[model samples]
Target: MAKSVAVIISILCILAFSGLSQCHEEPEFFVNGQVYCDTCRVRFPTRISQPIKGARVAVECRDRDNGTMTHNAIGMSGDNGEYNLTIKGDFENEICEVVVMKSPIAECAEVMEGLNRARISLTSKNGLLDTHRYANPLGFITSNPLFQCTQVLAELDLSLD
Candidate 1:
């Protein structure tokens, strides 16, 4: 009977210790960066002094040979134009599509002449962000057919190494 009690206590202790260890574990790792326009062949500058503080951006992972992938989460750039994406458990190996999401209340100034959407795709190696592998600086926009423009910028060739 004493042996059984001791075994039960040991099991409980192990479970408790394991839980505590998990609490101390670091957060799921991620990479943060900004999207830019591919200006001709050169990359557009990263410094934004404008008031584009609430621009929305999305990174959609597209599966190869399979249909369009789904990423329930979305990210937005801050006033300084920066974003951090948390990529975790069960991410697929595929090319990602990064696009700009239109705000419900878009301003006329925001809609510039010859301005379109932006997109980029690359081979993601696990948790690393491939700043170099990005979509075309000029993205296509079929969302608004009335005044669609082909706005292109340089948004590739970023290196963290």
Candidate 2:
């Protein structure tokens, strides 16, 4: 009879410990940033300022260079020209960039021709913002005028167990 009680008690203890571990597990972190027009020198606010809804951003991990491990999430800027993106997993010392695309959009403004796209650097892990990068502004304005948009995202550091 004592042996039976001991076995039952051990099972209950195991279950309780397992549940505690799950509850204490850390969740994936997400970081966010924004893009703006260099010509205007203002951010892309959704409702208040520049519209930044339906904007797509790609966060590629530069350290690993694993295209499969790259994370891509979509975001929209608020009225204050700010955007927020969520990244899954822990990314310690991970180098990332928030890239914008320009291809075929309204090719009207000459300023926008050279200042339509932008990028922001997302350095570190657990969702953090780092620096801002600008690439191919002139090409973006003159090459493809149909697609013009901005993206803000992050890169994550994948941990191996």
Candidate 3:
């Protein structure tokens, strides 16, 4: 019966199209960064600075229009202050940032200006071929300058007069 065959063919075609659509599902991203202490309180890392182990970091995606949070994932820094966080979504219309949530070192837990968060783009539409996106290092300032910081700064021409 031609009618029976037609029905079966139509069902097969529907299934094929659905599978094609599923192939275009959102892609995932690997965001990497570091969390460290600015021992000299200069808002940047120096030779005297050290990594903050066990620091809590997070990747947050927000809607650009209304500033509503869309997605978020947390990660922890290793002993070397490195973190690799995986976020699953295609955020072409959202703004994403890597923020420092907590520092394991109590003495160096104060977030410094312009060094607390790093903005990143998380969409494939941009010509960036690498799935791994690097963020600016997020850091906190230590309560007091380390003893070796004076020598480190002097070498870098950042010492006090």
Candidate 4:
């Protein structure tokens, strides 16, 4: 009788420990974002902005204390300018940013000054169960605004007025 009780207790302890580990399991981090071409020469993206396919994007993390690069991952945009990057490992105390590497479209190859990279956090220390982080849309600048952009700008000005 004592032997059976010990066996059952051991199984129960094992099950309890397994459940606790599962509860504390680390979550997978995923970063989802998009890249666009500013056809209207606007610093920000608009409804008329075109998505650039085959654009290269990179997620880089630098050590906050030394400013040295710690982690880097590259991904390419799909036909819809959407990119999903699976970031591995935790980058605690590091400053991470999603940066534009290259644009496949010739007209939208130039990176805008402040829109090239967006900062993001990669640690799960925050009270968020979902590890998915949505980054701001990064965009490339066109050499000249598209012809229709003039009408769009006019409408915008009229609305503001």
Candidate 5:
């Protein structure tokens, strides 16, 4: 009887301390990227590009074979248009992507064609020991080109017309 009581107390103590704090445990994966506004209407970021603040981004993982969604997480961009989303667990055989959901600015509300989603690998089997995975910048298009975009596009050898 005494042995059983001691065992129970030991488990209770372990549960109390371990469950109370998990500060040392590192997350399985972190998805990091930035949201940008394509002011040049060139479908990509340039010198005249603007960082979109308060943009909504999502991490969506789908089954590779069946094409069914397996995991989903949402994150909001900060003042600098940067977002870091924590994704738990390993998805060895899944297709994961970061997609732009919404742009807070009315002028930059339209999704940039071919730049809406950026693919990312979420598997540990890829031999990358780093937990930080970077996704390509996702952007939205502005209704009209910004004033400076004209000269900026020319300097960069790009044209929206």
Candidate 6:
């Protein structure tokens, strides 16, 4: 009876210590980003940024050594054009990028070259203590600039000078 009691106590102690260890474990990393529609067709986001809602975005991670893909996760922008992606697993030796997948709006369906994908670092090895990484805002360009875009661009140019 005493031996059984001792064994039970040992098991309980192990479980207690394991639970304590988990309390200090590192949390999963999250990537927060935004998507925008180039309303003025300026090829870049302006001060009057039009956030694209329901835009599809994805993060692709490639193995640094062999250049093979390691992970891919997709997410959609909310009403405010924001997305929060949870990256699973450690990608210490991987190159990650956020790419524009698709645009929900018909007018902004074309993905502009050079502005489509933004490279991001997913691993915490960069000396960042926080588990959240913010990627540069990705955007979609319209095939044709809006009629009011000319006036807006002129105003922007005037403000710049």
Task: Give the alpha-carbon lDDT of every model.
Answer: 0.44, 0.41, 0.90, 0.89, 0.90, 0.84
Between prediction 4 and prediction 6, which has the larger lDDT? Answer: 4
The residue ranges of model 2 lying beyond 4 angstroms of the native Cα positions read 1-20, 23-26, 40-54, 62-69, 92-94, 102-161
Candidate 3 regions exceeding 4 Å error are 1-22
Candidate 3 per-residue C-alpha lDDT over 39-65 given as tens digits, one digit per residue, 9 for 90 to 100: 988788787788988999999999999
| Better TM-score candidate (2, 3) | 3
Worst 10-residue lDDT window, candidate 1 = 145-154
Provide the lowest-lDDT 10-residue window in model 6: 152-161
Q: Report the C-alpha lDDT of model 5 over 105-151, residue by residue, as the tens digit.
A: 99899998789999998877799989999999998999988888878
Please tell me which model should have the higher lDDT, number 2 or number 3: 3
What is candidate 1's lDDT per residue for 24-89, written digit by digit as tens?
543342435543332222223332212234556666666666757755347765644455656543
Candidate 5 clashing pairs?
Answer: none
lDDT of 3: 0.90
> Candidate 2, residue 27: CA error in Å?
3.5
Model 2 — which ten-residue stretch has the worst lDDT? 152-161
Ranking by TM-score: 4, 3, 5, 6, 1, 2
Quantify how close model 3 is to the true structure by its C-alpha RMSD in Å: 4.8
- Output the number of the TM-score-best candidate: 4
lDDT of 6 by residue, 1-161 (tens): 99999999999999999999986665578988889988776678876658999999999999888989988999999987999999866678889999889999998888878888888777667888888888888898877666677667787774222
lDDT of 4 at 12: 100
Residue 16's C-alpha lDDT in candidate 3? 100
TM-score, candidate number 1: 0.42
Output the better candidate (2/5) by TM-score.
5
Error of 4 at 35 (Å): 0.4
